[model samples]
Target: MKKMIALSLLLMAGMMLFARGSKESGKTVVEIWHSNSGPSGTAFDEIVDDFNSTIGEEKGIVIEAIYQGLANDVLTKVKAAASADISSLPDIAQLDATACLDMRNADYLILPESADIEISEIHPAAIEALMSDKGLLGVPFNASSLLFYYNKTLFDSLSLNPPETLDDFAAIAPLLGEKDSTGKVTRYAFAGVPATYELGAFIGAQKGLSYIVDEKNGHMGTPSKVLFEEDGTFRNFLGHWKALYDTGFVNNITSGISTEFAAGRTATMLASSSSLTAVINTVGGRFEVGTAFVPMTDEEATGGVNIGGGAFFLFDSSDAVKTVIEYFVSQDVQMKWAEDTGYLAINTALYDNPEYLAFLDENPAFKVATEQMLQSNPAVTSIWLPSAYQIYYSFQSEIRAVTEDGKDIDEAVHDMATLIQRAIDEYRAQNID
Candidate 1:
């Protein structure tokens, strides 16, 4: 009877242990809500599925992504959810730079250093953008900057080299232009990016302005009071772009810029280096595409940053949120993520990996893009919204109108400045000092 009683107790204890292990090891789903749509969405889902199961453990963390647009739209949704006090907000959220400001303000994110990530190792600019007034708020996942992507075949045929300066760009435009019988060019030399960012890049490069006024203070890089004020640098850049557009030198064809570039109907394109693969895939390998550092006015370009691509956000205040965010920034995940996604790798050590070098060598398409890492920089001044976002969108609209409608550069620029300033004042009035 004693032996039987002992055996029964042993069986119960083993069962209890097994149950505890099962509970501890059971799969924890980290729901990811994103708008990585189309091919990107598909690829992202596959990657997540692969990662979720790669450990071959039944209890591994399963990342469930809800495909939603670019990173910003997902952030908008997140904002709406948060406003509603929705606790079921995805455990992990990916938002673009504009949304990062909102996330930081709301305390909706956490420091990456507290997680498993190698936080200090990423590019300072990327980290700077993620840090709030208090501390680091998010991980710089899928980070990128604007770079000059050009067609090598076209440049070779015209006996031209890649233009490295704005003057170079202007000088080469006529030579490389494919003109019609009417002496009008069907293929233009340069293109502008949406949201006034590409123009801002040129302005910053020309003026040698540090994106932020003071690097240490964590104030937003650009002063709302400055950019939209009289004779501001922002106004000047818009005027120049408007002139280019009115003269038919700048083509702002909304329907087919990407297709035109892919078909080699345009000479060059300014886009995210991360989209290098998308462009290549769109080009269907018909010709070789080359990437160069974005052109400049100064002998050495100082500005190299883009305004989009979301940060990795932690929705929950629990230890899980911190742990997962760190994982997102960690050398293991971030390096591989950057490599796979064509964004700037967060880890500097990734550049040294022989395997990475081999991958780059084998994939000649990534040569210019990968090189931009050594030469490129990060996003210009972070803008916190209500007014900042309104200004950004409104500025894009006015700038687009100036270019699209062939409006006068100086007059249009001054008008836009006034309009944007009003928006800024309205915002400050509502959310005062």
Candidate 2:
């Protein structure tokens, strides 16, 4: 009887030990909500899988992702979750730079230094976009900048190098196109939309004055005042662009600029570097596509292209969750992402990697995108304005009148100023000061 009791006690103790070990060794599951879809979605999943099998398995972490709708949809969902049940929020959520600004004050965000983030390894502009008074609001992800794509075939045939400034563009504009005897444009020198982003890039490239002024000690969420009208830079940009449009050198085809470039109907274009793969696929070996830095206003210009994209905002403050983010932003993973998706690598050192250098050598278009990124400035256009999208849409419409509808430059500028001021005033009045 004594022996049997001892045996039973030993067995119970053994089972307890086994259970505890199993519980301790089990992987911690980390959930990520993201808006990436289609090819981008697929590539992200592959990277996640790679992370799971390697770093994740070794560290006892399992990263899982759910495809929420778009970035805006995900933002809505996050707000809902934050208001209802804090426990319902995912460990990590992918949101846009703009939306992150709105949620800057949210208690859920895991700010920088929560983990070992190498701030110096990221582009300053990308870092700036996610920042608020509270510190770095999120981790930069899927970032991109404007790239100037030109046809190497055409450039070589004409013995013309890519333009380096507005003057070069002006000199080459009329020379690149074909006009009939009656001066009807049969081909175009450049193709772009009269949109806010396109116009903003031009303005920024010239080292023009700020479009929005940052008010120190103001409400962090609405910290900027619109200065587009008061600035001479905008007036000069409009006049120059309008003149080019008048000469039929700048084609205002709206949405078809990329198509025109792909079809070889236009000599040059400016597009998001994220579209590099699609552009290459569309070009389809017809001609060698060359990429160069978007021209500045002059040799002494000090400005950068705008940096825009989604970032990973942490809602659950867990060591495992932070691990997942660290892995995502690590140099190796970022380099892999750049290779697979043609999106700009978030790590600043990614451009210097030997593999990336080799890849860039083979893909000149991507190299151009990287070079352009080196000169990137913060996307200050509508970032702090309350009705940002509406303001931008209004600006786009007014600019189209100048470029496509023959509106006087001064008149169009005046109207844009009025529209933007009205929107800003309405926003300030409706919100708490």
Candidate 3:
């Protein structure tokens, strides 16, 4: 069933691509390099089509969006283009929020403020996450939050309610996992990547923990510092996770967690809100799927999730390109994008729109993310140095070594903090000069 859905989606996208390739003579073309694929990619292409027919026709502009690989790959391509030739870069690019600083530092992106780009229509947090030493770094697109997804059938079988607190989750997790007579694990309670996205959300779910320090706010322009070790949150969380791993309740595999969950070998997992479409497709008729606000700690029962996704950054400086961007962020366009792609709409007005409310009524699973966004905090990793993601992966490696290899947690945390501080120092040295 999953294969058939994937194949059909590909076929439809191929047909759409073929249909959109035809040029309308005399229209000025604006090229966009983006990392969106699958359903989001398809929805973006449709948005471009709608724009070309309506606003593009009126202004004699044609928007051409091309898939330029994933978020990180897009940065490499953009950097190469910057060092090579200006013409090689696309008019617009979608960059992961963490890497926005790199492009801004390289002068590869044009600040929307310079272009007098109006952003009053976008969500406040969305706009804030894109801000830098200059002006707005990018237009937030594909904004999303972390969500707790569970197999409803399994939960029902165990007479469990969806977890609301970390305590609840821990209590219920062991109940969901199973073993054979030989004590070999046959099922897992939780499984997911232990990177910044997951860990950041976990920390935010408990108050009084700052993941990263912003230089301008309190550090007086010092490079951002890792506060996890300082606050003891990282140590406590790691201990919890390590215990779960030792008990065989949680699997620490980097990949296949979602697949394992869908296959009934795992009960719950944390994932991006934008993954709703893909998850639904993968779990097609296998069992009912449920989504809830990510579990919070007891102190922060109303804890907020972190927003973690890429945004649209402009590299071109043309009125046509700016106009297309304006149109893209408009309420109508935002709603269409949200409905088609399952991303939270950046324009706040869309939330109260009758049409969007109706759509939410029909698709409650995706709405869980939207509701979470109302109380969401900007991911601390998003504000860290441009090398933040690289540091995060390294941190994840340390976690694996500690949890799976039985390394000392305190030693691992100290080493991980040192490694991250070094990366931040290097980034500041290079960019501040």
Candidate 4:
């Protein structure tokens, strides 16, 4: 009986040792919630898988990426989680640029500096897009800027060049337009509803860089009022936009813009650089597609397009999270991400990579956005607002009133400014302390 008891004790000790070993050897699972879908989703998965097979395996870290839905959906879920329980938030999240304000306000965030992650290699414009008074709010992952797309085949046939300024667009519109027997425009020079996305560039493209809101477009602090009206940026943009509209070669077609452009019914359109792949694929070689920087308000304009798309925000300061973030920003990963999704590679080092240079040499169309971004003033950035959605919709509505309803430009601008100011006031009252 004494021997049996001794043997039993030995077995228990061995089992406990085995359990401890297993726990120590297990991989650290890092959960990430993201809004990337379609091609971007596939590319992201490949990146995760590559990391898991390589660095992750070596370091005993496993990255588990979960699709949370679209950008807005992810933002909603994140906010809800933060409100309910800060501990319940995912280790990391990929959210839209508009979430900058929300992330800045959330005290639960694990900033890159706190996590000891280095981000000096990222493009200045990209960093500026996510930066606020609090410092870097998030790391730019998939970023984009606006590009002016035109039918190269048509432009070449007429010996014309893509417009460099808004005035050029106005002058070129009549040349590219076609009219039916009744004087109704059959083919429009441009077809798009101007909104906040496009307006960012227009407002910024002024001497000394005009901002839509005070506080340097809400980067320094929470904005109390808009600057567009006082600065006359809106008025200046309207004068140019009104001229293009008065040419009667522009349309407010919101939907089917890509289709119309592809079908050769439209001459030019402004679209996000992220949509370049889709735009090209939609054309399907029916005509050569051309891309340029979104035309400036004038030749003297010093600003450029505002960075758009989503960024990665961390909630945990785990080494595993930092590793994953570093891996995503690596040169190979960023180059592949850009190639796969048509999003700009945020890594500035890619410009010097021989492979990337070769890729650009072979595919010149992909170079326009990068060139434009490099040339852009760092002051040009998105308007960070808590009521960004309402403000974006309001911009579209007010511009439509001017272009479609024949409302006076001055009245539309005033109404837009008033509505946006009200939104800011309401948001501050409800959310601010």
| Best candidate (score: TM-score) | 4
lDDT of 2 by residue, 1-433 (tens): 9999999999999999998875546789898999887557778999899988998889999888999998878988998988999999998899875575466657677776675555678877788766666777888888877678888899999999998876688888888888889988777888876455555566655553254434421225555455555665567777666666666777766677878998888999988677777777789989888878777655544466766667888877778977888788889888877776667887878767888789888876677677666655554322445555776677777777878788877787778767766765675676653
lDDT of 1 at 293: 77
Candidate 1 lDDT over residue span 260-311, tens digit each: 8887678887887677667878888788887787777445446554334556
Instruction: Order candidates by TM-score, high to low.
Output: 4, 3, 2, 1
CA lDDT of each prediction against the hidden true structure: 0.63, 0.73, 0.76, 0.88
Clashes of each: 7, 0, 0, 0
User: Alpha carbon lDDT of residue 408, candidate 4?
Assistant: 85
Candidate 3: residue pairs that collide:
none
Most accurate candidate by lDDT? 4
What is the alpha-carbon lDDT for the whole of candidate 1? 0.63
**Candidate 4 lDDT over residue span 158-240, tens digit each:** 99999988899999899999999999898999998878889889888788488988888888887889888888888888888
> What is every candidate's alpha-carbon RMSD to the true fold?
8.0, 8.0, 8.0, 6.4
Better candidate number, 1 or 4, judged by lDDT: 4
Give per-model TM-scores. 0.81, 0.83, 0.88, 0.91
Off by over 4 Å in 4: 1-25
Q: Write candidate 3's Cα lDDT for 80-198 as tens digits.
A: 88899977988888887566657666666787877778888788767766666666778887787778899888888878888776666677777989999998878888886578677
- For model 2 the TM-score comes to 0.83
